[model samples]
Target: MLEAQSRHGRTVLTTLCVLALLACNRPPEIQHDAVFGPSHGAVGDTLWFSARALDPDGDSVGVRVAWGADDTSGWTGFDVPGKLESLSYVWHDDGYRIVTAQARDIRGALSNWSLGRGVSIGVAPVRPEPPIGPGYVQLDREYAFRAVSRDTSGHERRLRYVFDWGRGKLDTAAVSYPSGDTVIHRHTWRTPGTYEVRVKAITDRVGIPSAWSEPRRVLVDSALGSLIWQYVLGAEVHSSPALDEERGLLYVGCDDFRLYAVTTAGGPVWQFVTSGRVRTTPAVAPDGAVVFGSDDETLYCVGPDGLLRWRHGLADKPGPAPALGPGGAVAIGDESGRIHVRAPDAGEWRSYRTGGRVRCGPAFGADGTVYAGSDDRLLYALTPACSLLWSYPATGRIRGSPAIGAGGTVHFGCDDGAFYAVAPDGGFRWRYKAGGDINCSPAIGADGTVYVGSDDRWFYALDSSGRVRWRFKSDGRIKSSPALGDNGEILFGADGGSFCVLNGWGDLMWDYDAGNDIQTGPVVGSDSTVYLAGTDGRLHALRTGCRLATDAPWPMYRHDARRSARAGGPH
Candidate 1:
């Protein structure tokens, strides 16, 4: 019974082996399905193929991929039973192609090919070129500029061009590509200087459509060679220099107890000895006479030739720069707390007293009113007849001249670190807190921006509404009043002995080093020259790139009797 059972088991085993051999003898079956993603694509688009294959005989299967047009990644290694695969191809040329796949079993048996999705390629877009434009502009005047760029891509797109004016100003414009490569732009420079102008092209699809072309230098206003001439004096100069356009002479006072007349070429024209140091800026009269006060308790009037025309003794030392009013009337103040007015034709004068020393000079209004500040912490408004019209009290002593605004407002700074803008009727309009002592007069721009410097070492620009527009820091205290250039540059000096020029937006354009502290203000001549006095007793001359005014001149501390601090004309 055991033998019979063994034989039957052997028979069964043989039968199973025969069946297994028969299956192995049969060729492995291969079946695969594949699909290409993004059925349609551009010339540069990458296409993806996903494929699945099976071996009916339970043998390993491999995938062979073929991208039509000879684009193929060949066969993949075999796996057990079935295979899942993915392939990618980028269309380099513009055309249509079909992706297909086949499968092979471990027995080297091949199957029919399975078709994949079709893909199409189109032409790609081309990048545009750099922009081209002109490279020259005049200071303070607008110039028409044009820039050109083009797109090479056959497809239409929008292109943008950016113009870097190189003076803290920029502009952007967009146009239709292919047809639009040229654009017209206009700009005005507020200061005279050299700057580089360039443009870049861009598109929504491509970043920086083209590289920025080489920059072209634009020359502003002055073409004078870069030469700064200085005239050395015997003592420190705390006075602003006066310019004589007719003879190209500069008049300034020195702590050496003398007033000097210097040629614009930095040559000494002459000197007039005073009893004491002169700390006041010389005021030029309509008749070409220069008037200034000295700590010697006297005010000296000198002719354009540096000859002393007259001298008036004051009751106390005069610290304020003299002002010339309409009809040649001269107004000044002294430590005695008195504001003195002299008749245009004679030395006869009248005085108005304040509670504190009068170290600040008086400014005239368009309506014939006089505005002055006092150490007594008050700002006084007086009629041309010397009668007090009104007085506005401040928290600190006022040591600077009052500036009249176009709207009849009076602006001044005080020792209390405050700047006040009062109405013409002596009513408070607004007050701005400063970082430190506010002892400098404010200058008004044509656009109603106010400029003043502080002992805090900052120069501030305030709008007509009393809001700070911008502030620039200096190395030291800035007691010097800010002067406006014809082209909108702000000029001032610092106790650090540096003189700086700032644009209308409070950007520093340039600066010069003076050997000593500069407590004096700066002035722009009609010929666009700059005049500055240094505590080192030297007067420096520089180019301002402004046009000279033949109609009037900067005759006093704040330029005009109005003390608006606005130079040139109504602007």
Candidate 2:
């Protein structure tokens, strides 16, 4: 009985195998129900698939759906739809994650996965954003600057900015995202002249600083080819020098305790020893005698041979360079708060006790009224007899000498950072504020306009009302008084180590570099030749670009020159 059953099982298995082989050799029918969906979709988009089976016997059959997750994954069963032919699932939160679905007919017998009836489901890519901005930065005012940055993946981008002048910094500090387009930004000058404004833009990055914008040089005023300066005494000069044409010598003084005699060739020929450093220029008499003041509290009389002739002690620290009055008499001020008058060949005369220390050299008005400024911030008008006529208070200490104007106006710069035009009666006429201290005396023109430089690095032209008519910004501080050319151009020196020429409108005409500070005032020659000395121990000469001449110099007034002479004596 066992043998008969075994034979029967073998005969049935053999017949089934033969049938499967025959079916394998036949071609697939390839019939399928259609499935449709969006050609492209974001992650989480849904898809649909449907199919029906036609098996020679019309019986209910199971249709298994299968898919693969990656190149390493073998085919696995994908979930079937509950009641509808569509199935929805979120695309995994990863880029390029492969997804797939297949539809199969519900057949009673199972068959292998078929390629002809299935479709692929792939994820679409996403675009990433660029970073906000970079590191620290600076830009010019009104400059169109950009802040650029990139993503972790190295995608490039740019940023925008709003510069704030009132704050002297940037307007926005946000780590804002960048737009695809370029943005415009602007900066403005709060004051006229040349300026180095900074512009910066932060990127999307939280901590990185944006790069500085390209330097945009805006000229609120012209600064081209300004003058360069030179020196001849090999020391810091507080007073300007005088050229003794007949003797071909430059008489000047320095804080170095000596009165220097500089030859036109630019080297010291002789030096007169003083009890103290000579801060005032010498007054050369026809007799060749040199008169000046020394901080050692004495007035020095030096012979042309460079010998000290006399030393008149005032018993006070002289802060002013001596000014010449009549009869070779000299007027000098000291830190003792007194202005003294004495004869060139004699000792002390009358002295006036000013309210404060007098640092500036006194000016001789046409009528013998002395005009001078004190650390007390007052401009005093005194009689030749040493009695004060009036005392006017300025906003600050006045260092520059006061020039008498056509309207009886006195123009001078104050430590208040402004130039003032005051009436001889001690009334304020006008004041123009510069960006910095104006320690320079003003050069007055026939038109009532005033010219002066400030620590603000600017040379300015001011109207009678103290309004700025024009201004020129420079690369350095302007501490020297301006020498107006006879034709209306201006000459001045800058801490930038150069003396420059400017047109009437403040346009730069030419410049010469002396590579040193110029503390001396400029003098124009008769032929319009300009002479200025720098701390470099050289005297520079320029021509035709300014308004005054080197020959007939408009007195820079105070006790300004290393030596000033009118007919003869210290007066």
Q: How well does each candidate superpose onto the true structure, as a TM-score?
A: 0.63, 0.55
Per-residue CA lDDT of model 1 for 266-311, tens digit only, reads: 8888888988988887777766788999989998998987788888
lDDT of 2 at 304: 67
lDDT of 2 at 240: 66
Query: How many clashes show up per model?
Result: 2, 59
Q: Please give the distance, in angstroms, between residue 274's alpha carbon in candidate 1 and its true position after superposition.
A: 1.9
RMSD of 2: 20.3
Q: Please give, for residues 379-495, the per-residue lDDT of candidate 2 as tens digits.
A: 887776777899887888887766666646777788879678888788889877788887777776667777788898888888878888988997788877776654446778889
* RMSD in order of candidates: 15.8, 20.3
Which residue pairs come into collision in candidate 1?
A: 43-122, 526-548
**Predicted candidate 1, C-alpha RMSD:** 15.8
